[model samples]
Target chain A: MKVRQVSIFLENRSGRLAGVLSEVAKAGVNIRALSLADTSDFGILRLIVDNVDAGVKALKDSGHTVSLTEVLAVEISDRPGGLAETLEALSAADLNVEYMYAFVCRVTEKAVVVFRFEDVDAALAALKAADISVLPANTVYAI
Target chain B: MFNPQAEAMPREELRKLQGERLRSLVARAYERVAFYRAKMDAQGVRPEDIRGIEDIVKLPFTEKSEFRDQYPFGMFAVPMSEIVRIHASSGTTGKPTVVGYTRADIDNWAECAARSLGCGGATAEDTVQVAYGYGLFTGGLGMHYGAEKLGAAALPMSAGNTEKQVMLMKDFGVTVLCCTPSYALQIAEVAEQMGEDVRSFPLKAGFFGAEPWTQGMREHIEERLPLKALDIYGLSEVAGPGVANECLEQDGLHVFEDHFYPEIIDPETGASLPDGEKGELVFTCLTKEGVPLIRYRTRDITLLMNSGPCACGRTSRKMARLMGRTDDMLIIRGINVFPSQVENVLVRIEGVHPQYLIIVDRKGNLDTIEIQVEVTEDLFSDEVKKLEALRDKIHYQIKAMLNVSAKITLVEPKTIERGLGKAKRVLDRRQRI
Candidate 1:
């Protein structure tokens, strides 16, 4: 299952991240999981929000370059080696994870991780074959 | 000391020679080039009226734009069969400003270049390593032919490959280096990095030009490399690198007045400024046969000093070091880069705003240009690969167009500071003369 992630381009300057977060908050969107990739010149802000379309619109209207990306959400047991175990399957399946971030679910003792893979379909197939609990867009958004 | 008779000619005799040359040049240009004919006709002036150097004011001023207006071969006074070589420099637009030379013209250029090199202490026994980029740019071939003309062995080491440059310099016993001032320093830094004692090289002198460099840079270069750093001045439109040179006196560059006559004019009102007063520098090509120019506005700001004879025995009027350009054209790494050219590239790419900021700085003896472009919503992608691709596209296009590599930084839409009226586009931080 694929989840839509809102990613905004941020310049590596003072208060740039805060400015984007304020724009998302003003749009009345709740952030699920977020990760920031940065270089010396600029940064890429990858965000998974409860409502992707509204968050993107607010950022774009505020003159930020925003785009939508499809990432996968996987549920795992909240344990010492939960991420390690999930990663071992992807490595064996030869699926490359471009990036990943995690968030603990309040409704259960499980953790939800958002992943961007080189190939989403291949990653989804591998996760299914591994019998991992792959959550859909609605289930992740509700959490 | 090369061509001593001409280089040390008295002012009275030199003026007579320049007057005769200018008279013939106008006649040839009026009779051949239709663009020159029209401009002269529009000014209600004819060739016969320009009988002497004093009558130069009667000729129409040829602007740089006229060169672009008369594209490929429109400005050449001679037929295509007579042209032996063609050189082009970057223009304000996509097309370059083209210049052509006949056999005699090439010979004259070689002689001028040789004289320039000789002024900087080059002799027939010296081996010159021409490090300026060859091709459409005139710096490399210009110096190469000059070294050959001077009877010195010419090493056509066209720019880059720093390791090879140093290796060849040591192994071949290069006595003279010819390139932009910044690049000469770059070579010295590279040599030091390679564990070579930079000052131990046999390089005696260097002719640095094609870009504006300060006296401080010259001193710095001399300190790093054991050589007499001399400033050579020229433009492709004005017959390339041998129009003027500093004759070891380091006072001012002596304009080869017998060939290319110099004048200082008010940049705003077009009135001639007196000697020693700073204004826009203009030149009238007195001996050019292919594309003879009459009072071509050079856009270079400098003054002519006619005070007595120089200690080096050259009697030609000397021009002070170039102050700056009257236009927004930035000379990065000896390449002419117009802001509008960058703007043209930006506008052509979809979703890129025409507004851009060009930041030019000197990074470790080399010029660095950084272009800050605002990223539009239509151009951005969530994936880092796609965003990087967009940045690479801009970088590649700019490099292709300007012939100079630029660091492109894509910023948030409103992050770039907008000016009140005309948004300032260029921020030059380089220490230039």
Candidate 2:
């Protein structure tokens, strides 16, 4: 299962992240999980929002460089080594995780982890074979 | 001294020589060049009208655009047979401002350059490495022949190849360095990176020109390389890189008044200003044969010092170090840049808005320019690689047009500020105290 993640290129100027967040807020989109990759000159703001289409549209209208990325979301037990176990499974299957971020759902005991993998299909198959629950796009959006 | 008698001649005697040369130059230009003849005729000024240097103000000023309108060789006084070499400055469009030199003109160029090197304390026993670019540009060959004319060992190691330049400097004992000041700093950087102490090398002095440098840069170069850094001034239109040079006194550059007569003029009105007043520096090529220029507006902003003998024992007048330009032309790492040139490149590329900002600054004694341009909504894609490719495309086009590298930052549309009147296109932060 693939979840759509929104990534926006932000110049490394002050208040850029806040500006993007305000735009998403105005669009009535709730960000589920967010991560930032930054260099000296620029940064990439990635977010998994409840309303992807509306968030992307709002950001694009605000003159931001936005992109859509397909990522995988997996559910794991909220234990000491929840992320470590899922990562071990992917590593054993030779699936490279480009990046990952996580958040816990309030209604559920399981922690939801988002991952960008080199091969989404292969990673999904490996997680399925390993008996690790891979969340669907709808479940990720609902969270 | 390259020409001891002329270099040390009395002020009145030098002025008399300049008067004779000016009269001869005006007569020759009036007879040979139709452009000069037409300009003089329109002004109702005859060749005989210019009897001395005082009458020089009556001559019409020669603009750089006249060189472009003439194109390849329309300004040459001599025929193609008498021409010995040609050099050109990069033009805004495709056509460059070409300058030709006769055999005697070449000799004069070499002599001037030799005198310039001598001003930097270079002698016959020294080995000078000419690192300025060769071919079509006057820097390389001008310095090369000048070093040879001074009876010094000339290392014709043109521009680039930093490692090799350092190696030759060490192995051959390069006592004199001839190149842009930025490249001198670059050589020092490479030498340090290679675990070689720049101070241990035989670089006793450096003749840095083709670019505007600050006292801070001079201090940095001198401290890093532990050598005397001097500024040399020239242009391709005015007989290359030896029209003037700073002597050992580290004062203003002494103009080779016997050949090239210097004048300060109000850039707005084209009226000659007296010495010691800051104005546009203009030159009249008094001894040139191929292309004898009259009141050629250099666009360089500087002032002429009082004419007298200096402590260095030179009688020629000196020009203060260049402050800036009368126009918007930016000299980045010795290459001339105009805002319109960048605009020209942006206009040709699709999806790029013509509105742009050029930011020029000095980083590590070298000039760096960053051009921020706005792209259309369709061009602002979600793909990072695609956006990077578009940025690279603009970068490559600008590099091809300007012959200088610049960082291209593709911003969102309307990010660059717009003004109601003339849009502020350039922000030069260099030379700011």
Candidate 3:
């Protein structure tokens, strides 16, 4: 599936976030999923927008520093055993999860998981080899 | 603003004045300067044949390269003992172009410079702090003599030592700051970090030049220092810093037509361009006796507009702000690129530091372009992959923007060499055939 994500470095200043968001919105990039990782001096704002290219362009044209990364979307269970099974499968595949976050699923009673891995294609192949549900970009966007 | 002499003299009267001076200067050059005499004689021309200003165009134009070819003191009209001051260019190769000035030349230079600086509304009561580099660079000495001639309290602060500059600016009540535009921003940044109140400082105006700057940067510097930013334009061989300056109205710079004659010529064709048409700027020193240059091509791309009375009521030709130089354009794989374009790209990228360089080299039979960009310390990461990816994305964006392939290399902040006087931003390695 599609896993294009935009990672932007933004100065910790007033109106900076609004400036980036306004440009992206003007470029018609629908907000898919978003999170901000903060550091002492600045913050790294990541986004999964409907148009990854447009979002990257918007952030760039508006003068915010941006980088693109491919992330894997893994379908995990909403219940306690779901995420544990997924992690165990990844660990068995010799894959390392750099960071991950929870996302809502389109299907009822299920959870969607997004993870940044050391090797994106390898991680996806590992999960698929184990019969773990690896969601596509369309499915993740819908979720 | 228009020059009062050129605008008000009426075309015929201006012609007569220029003719009279042209004949006198030509006759003097023929008699006193052996080089000019030889060149004119080789063409079978006499100074008497150049009777008027129209005849000036007929005479061969002297170039800066000719001075370099002849080396030190070959073009001086007067004897060696009469030359009171000697100035030189800082070029590394060949003999540096040397300029010699007589006591009278220095006086005229100071007067023209003072008149130009006077356009800024600086008075004798004002303390003028010279922030440009001193010694060999004519920018510092040229402005210094001008402010002194104006009877302004001159502080030879010279360059750098930010703390001392700010200290003198505060203690001496400096009213006018003189330096390159880039240095002005650097000083402002230092002042801001030190919690100095720039507005409270006595600086009412800044005479900034020796570098090309954009209108946005001009506004930024004006806002930072809370003073009127004035652009001063000139070169070391022609007469640095005081050749042209913007008036209070700030429409354009008024070339010192009384002392220096300006003509816009097509850089490629060498044909004279009409006023309001952008072209290369060329100047001839009519009054300068020390190292007088005739039709020295400055290669700076700008337009000359003679229409409309300026906010200031002078009659000189107003030169539009320089766009960029034709000579400074970088050729990449048969494509011409200007650093200004790269600057436009970098400045638009948030957190990309202003310190950047364009490296052009010959890779195989083709050319290669690498943009060395500085990463702000705040954005520095420990991970190489993350940084490498960022560099690749920048490379792609610049390639898209300029329509040329480029490599982006990020250097640690403050690693790029800082300039002492004129900043060197472009490094071209292709051997000229």
Tens digits of per-residue lDDT for model 1, B1-433: 9999999998899989998998899899999999989988999998899888999988888888878778888998888999999998765465677899999999999999999998987889999999998888889899989999999999999999989999999999899999999989989989999999979989899999988899899889999999999999998988889999998889999998898999999999899888999999999888999888889999999999967799999999999999998999888888888898899888887745645799999998999999998877677776677778888989999988887899999888876678998888999999866
Candidate 2 per-residue C-alpha lDDT over B303-371 given as tens digits, one digit per residue, 9 for 90 to 100: 999755699889999999998888899899889999988998887877344678999998876799999
Cα error, candidate 3, residue A133 (Å): 55
Better of 1 and 3 by lDDT: 1
Q: Could you give the candidate ranking by DockQ, starting with the highest?
A: 1, 2, 3
lDDT of 2 by residue, A1-143 (tens): 79999988777789988999999999999998888876555566789999999999999899777778899989989989888998999999998877787888887867988888767889889999999998889888888
Cα error of candidate 3 at position A60, Å: 37
Which candidate tops TM-score? 1
TM-score for all models, in order of appearance: 0.91, 0.83, 0.58
| Stretches of model 2 off by over 4 angstroms after superposition | A1-9, A12-14, A29-143, B92-94
Error of 2 at B408 (Å): 2.2
Candidate 3 lDDT over residue span B81-114, tens digit each: 9889888875333366788889988887787778
The root-mean-square deviation over C-alpha atoms between each candidate and the true structure, in angstroms, is 3.1, 5.3, 13.4
Write the number of the candidate with greater lDDT, choosing between 1 and 2.
1
The runs of at least 3 residues in candidate 1 whose Cα sits more than 4 Å from the true structure, single-residue gaps closed, are: A1-4, A22-29, A50-63, A68-100, A115-139
Ranking by TM-score: 1, 2, 3
Q: Assign candidate 1 its CAPRI class.
A: medium
- Classified by CAPRI criteria, candidate 3 counts as incorrect
Error of 3 at B387 (Å): 22
